[model samples]
Structures are given as structure tokens and as C-alpha cells.
Target chain A: MTHSDPLTIAGKTFTSRLMLGTGKYHDFTVMRAALEASGTQIVTVAIRRVELKAPGHDGLLDALNLERYQLLPNTAGCRTAEEAVRVAKLARAATGVNWLKLEVIPDPKYLLPDPIGTLKAAEILVGEGFTVLPYIQPDAVLARALERVGCATVMPLASPIGSGRGLRTSELIRTVLDGAAVPVVVDAGLGVPSDAAQALELGADAALVNTAIAEARDPAAMAHAFALGVQAGRLSYLAGRMAERESASPSSPVAGVVRLPDPEIPA
Target chain B: MQVNGQPHPFTPGLTLHALLRELAIAPERVAIAVGDDFYPGGQAPDCELAEEDVVEIVRAIGGG
Candidate 1:
């Protein structure tokens, strides 16, 4: 892609369109290597209470190079707008970064985003000057509403979080893409590199991958594969594809007519 | 005082520095929220904790 084609979100430009989540990794070493292999400029982390009984265990800051990645803190465990706002504030205070990934999943079983709660939280966070990237179900109307409320990006899930189900909501996601004024990031449940590629091919600005890479036997290798897949899909989209038709067309010239004698042996 | 939603032993003039030290928590590794006020780790040394304060000490964890 050209310099002018970089993924721009909230007035900030990112060279790499792949975003990563720092979760479900075997260890920090693997996570670090995977992050490097993936070539992601934005990485997501969650804000959590320091367990009094378990101090020094949560060391995300120590493991990750802060300068290398733009940390997009997510409100993962929050079930309401108030809780998300609290988490957002805590995240901003800790990292001094205003960019947030707002997720309000009230349902524990399905883990689907609560659109009403998400919208409410987005409005509040955006008003507070946080560049919000909200995780949501694939709904075109909600995406437009979020854009109207000054969200930096809208992240629609392909399937349930960590399910590795790979674009179960493609039609809905396409609708969101068609209507989105801001960047559209297909997040969650991307099973493989092709899944990510398909999202990019379908005109999504980016894809956020976590489980598929992290849970793989070779996370770093899988990450590299995903990076290449994303680039390939993006290039294919730019190159454009041929139109499909019901009947097949001849590749060779049909004007050349050759008459061959019937074989006696075949008869 | 409630710290992280649990009642902890309260001291009259406990600074965040002393509390963190007592808890064996590194000040630079966490962010402190006392009621509605947010205090970064750098400000912990000067900020004192009140007896009836509700504090929340948080840090970054692995998540998507």
C-alpha cells in the first residue's frame, strides 16, 4: 500500500493494519515474539484490580515495550456504562493514553456486547476526550450511531470472543462496513490467517486477532502467517477481482475452427 | 477503609507510599483511585489516605 493508504484512526496514522490483543498467551516471551512477528502497531490490554493476595503477577507494563506499541486499554470485564467509565479512567490514569476499547458485555453466557450500554459508554468516553474504539455486535445502525458520537473506530466481532469461529456474521459485518464513516476493525473469533484475510478483503480497515495465534503451537509463526495474510488480502482488494457470470467464457480465440477425422478404433 | 471492595485495616495518617510499602506492592506498577480522585504512581508519595476512604489499586493485565 502507498503512504497515503495507511490506516488512519482518530487523526493518528498506523502503518500496520493488524492490531493484537495481549491475552491467552503461554508466556510473555512468546507474547513479545508474537507481537513482533505480527507487526502490530496497536496492542490491547485490560485494566484489573491488583489482587492483594497476588501482587507482582500482573506485569504487562514490564513485559511489553511501551514505546513500541500504542496500548489500547479495553474495558473487558465491565458490565455497565458506569463500570466501563471507571475502568477507562483507571486505564488513562495508568498509561496516560486516552485511546480506549470500550466493551460492555452484560451477558456472561454469550458474551455478546450490550449495544445500549456500549453506546451510553461511548458517548461518555468520547465527551471526556477518550478516542474510543468500541467492541460491538455487527449492527450497521449502531455503528453509524457510534460514529456520530465521535468514536475513533467501531470493532464488530466475527463471532463470540475466543470462539475462533471465523466470520460467522459476514453479512452483518459487511453492512457495518458499508455504513461506517470511521475505520472498521473486525475483532474477536478470527480462527486463522484466512479469516483475517477475508475480513480485510471484505473492506474492513483492520483485524484484531488474539486466540488463534496465541493458542497455536507456534504462536510467533502463526503471527507471521497472519501478517502476510493481511497484506495479501489488502493487496488483492486493491488489485480488484474479475466479475462472476453464470456461463464460462473461452480463454482462446473461438474464430479458429479445426476439423478432425473421427477415429475408426474409437467407433 | 475499603480497598478493592474489601475492608482493610485503617490507619489515621497513612500515606499511599507507606500503604504500598506495607502491602509489598511496587508503587510504579499500579494506579491508585481514592473515592473519585485518581493518583498516578508518581504522586503516591505525597498523597495521604484517609481513614474512611475507598481506594482501588489497579494495574494492567492480559486481555483482548
Candidate 2:
């Protein structure tokens, strides 16, 4: 409940374990309110070609108070390592923040991250002194590889992007957690707060959410709910869990049962 | 020169600031990349643009 135990990534500490994506909001007003409600210290934004006279592009720079939230620029639309690297450079130049969410999603249909591209980009970006957080499929080996390559974090998706599916690769995510030397932030395809909570409960350092909160009936309210869920999950994880058993265990002492006289017999 | 994948009229010895002025794009709202050379918002003023270069002007948008 307190901010004593902070989530540390790349030597930076964050009180809130929930990260938010600044996309799919109805407007900047709602986005601002949701972001404030979510209590997210880091917000993800995409860098794309600025369309002249575009409505949405002009406002985000002004909406987010940089003092309150740290902007994490993402290479969302890039398909290759080179493209992702270029976007990372452009994002760093534009945002003046070296923190990057390196995403190289080549397949547009499912919007899945390319493992090869992501690894290559992570290596290059980390080499350039950028704090790279590479998003990839829930592959344990790849997660370790990225960690070895100096990535700040390995963000493994729970499911396909924007699918609203919760923890389809939970087993794989567990494998990632098993050997992880760095923080693992579960990113993408979390449908509800429970999904985010589940990620934390499974030993994830954090969870990044977008569609679930942005598209909610009340984005701000849902954001608050997610924050609570994350906290609850973290607390529960710290509190630990009971062991499983095949048979039922009695809450009361079985040996303390009072013996009753038999009604039958010679009485 | 190509801007955002569209062919634009090449101005000889054009600086990035002058090109932004010509296109009516606010320099603070976008980051420019001339081929592999990158220029953050404020630093693009002195960067020169070449005729055959592909220029990508990008802005921060909502994304997860």
C-alpha cells in the first residue's frame, strides 16, 4: 500500500507497477483523466509520420504533463530491426527521452512482435545508451537473450495485441519469470484488471495496459480499478499462497471431535 | 525530395527550417529524419535537406 517497495527498472524506481498506453482514447480530456486515475508514472506513445492537418497528432504533446508522467516512446509500426532502430532514434530525438518500448510487429493481421527484429533492435538501441524495453512473444529463451543483450526490461505479451485475451501464454510467461535476471513487464492483450493482476501475481515486475482501459465504458474508473488490481496482486504475491493438496483439509482439529455413545447395543 | 512517402518539390540547398516554413508545418510538433540523419524538434533548423533524401517528419501519437 505504501510506496516503500518501488519497482526498479534500469536503476529507476516507480511506485506504480502499472504502465499505460496513450492510445485509443476518445479525446485528450478522457486520456488525461484516465492517466491521472491510473497513477501510472510511465506512459507509452507511438512515433509515426505526422500527417499534415491531422487532428490527434497535435494535442498529445500538450496533453501529457511531462513533470507528472515519463513519456516512453514506442516503435510500434516498425517491421524490421533497421526500421525500429530508425524510429527509436527519431523518438529519442523528438521526446528527448532515451527510454524506448522497442516493438517490431511485422505481421499486421495479429500484430505480433517479431522476435528477430525485436532482439536486433534491442541490441542496437542498448548499445546506443538507450534504455530499451523490448516487447516480444511469451518466449522464455528470447526473454533471457534480450536480458543478456542489455535491455532494461523484457515485455512479453500475454496474447495477441488488442485481443482482450487474458494470459493465453501464462505458462510461457512463468517460464520467462523462472530464469529472468531483469524485470519482466507483461505487455499487450490484457482484457481486464484481473489480467493485469494475474501478471503481477505470477511474479511480473509490471503490466502495461491499453485497449482494456482506453475503451472501457468509463476509462478513468477502469484505470483506477486496474491500479487497485495491480496493488492487490502485488500484495497477494508477497503474502504468498497455500500449498495444493489432492484431498480436502479440515479447518478444525479432527482429533478434538467428541465421542458419542452408541444408541444401539444393550442400553 | 520525398516527405512522408510523398514526393515533394525539391528546393535547392533547402534547410529543414525553411522547408518546414514552406510546408506550413510547425517545427516544434514534429521530429525530422533525413534518410539516416535524425534531427529532434529544435535541432532541425540548421540541418540541410538533399534532393534525393527521404524525409520522415513524425509526431507523438497515442499508442500502447
Fnat of each prediction, in sequence: 0.73, 0.77
lDDT of 2 by residue, A65-91 (tens): 998887899999899999999999999
Off by over 4 Å in 2: A53-57, A255-261, A265-267
Residue runs of model 1 more than 4 Å from their true location after superposition:
A2-4, A255-259, A262-267
- Residue A187 of model 2: what lDDT? 93
TM-score of every candidate relative to the true structure: 0.94, 0.95
Q: Please report the candidate that would top TM-score against the real structure.
A: 2
TM-score, cand. 1 vs. native = 0.94
- lDDT for B49 (candidate 2): 76
Of candidate 2 chain A, the 10-residue stretch with the lowest lDDT total is: A50-59
Clashing pairs in 2: none
Q: Quality of candidate 1's docking, in CAPRI categories?
A: medium
**Poorest stretch of ten by lDDT in candidate 2 chain B:** B40-49
lDDT of 1 by residue, A1-267 (tens): 736679999998998989999999989999999999999999999888998887877589889999889999999999999999998988888877899999999999879999999999999999999999999999999999999999999999999999999989999999999957999999999999999989989889999998999999999999999998888778877878789899999988888668686586575
Pick the DockQ winner. Answer: 1
